[model samples]
Target: MARRGPKSHWWRTRLLAIAIVSVWAVVTLALPFFNSISNGTGPGGVGIYVFMAEGVLVLMLALVFWFARRQQAIDREFAMAEED
Candidate 1:
């Protein structure tokens, strides 16, 4: 059995996290600008929106992790065969 280090997929994990946080940040920053024109539909406040986005981000990140791991496995196998 080969031992793989956590760093193998850490970048993808961190990217997913950053994307989640960015969603919250963008919504929070844009709400004020959007309100200046007309009402569509948005979070009442930043705090609540953060909670909502956090949930979405977490679910999405889990899926990202699943896919990334599968892809990594395929890549590792191909690399090993190429070395032979």
Candidate 2:
């Protein structure tokens, strides 16, 4: 395998950052578009606004969680993970 150093680590980190930001931006921007399509009551007859809020909140939370885990993995690969 090719040698991995700070340069490689930095490159991987940048890639991960880009990926996370892209996904975040897409989700944030697409929410309204998707909301327009699903504009109606949700389960239990909840209003579209409430449903979209809850869905977007959950999605944002999940995205954050995923980013943390993925970043950690990249850090570990470079022996840069924080000690617990």
Kindly list the per-residue Cα lDDT of model 1 for residues 1-84, writing each as its tens digit.
223455645554567567656755665556546554444345555554554457556755776676656555644643421332
Least accurate 10 contiguous residues by lDDT in model 1:
75-84
lDDT of 2 by residue, 1-84 (tens): 234788998898899889888888877777667666656545534565665678778988998899899888888888888888
Error of 2 at 57 (Å): 0.8
Q: How high is the lDDT of residue 49 in model 2?
A: 62
Reference-based lDDT, each prediction: 0.54, 0.77
Q: Model 2: residues >4 Å from true position, as ranges?
A: 1-3, 34-51
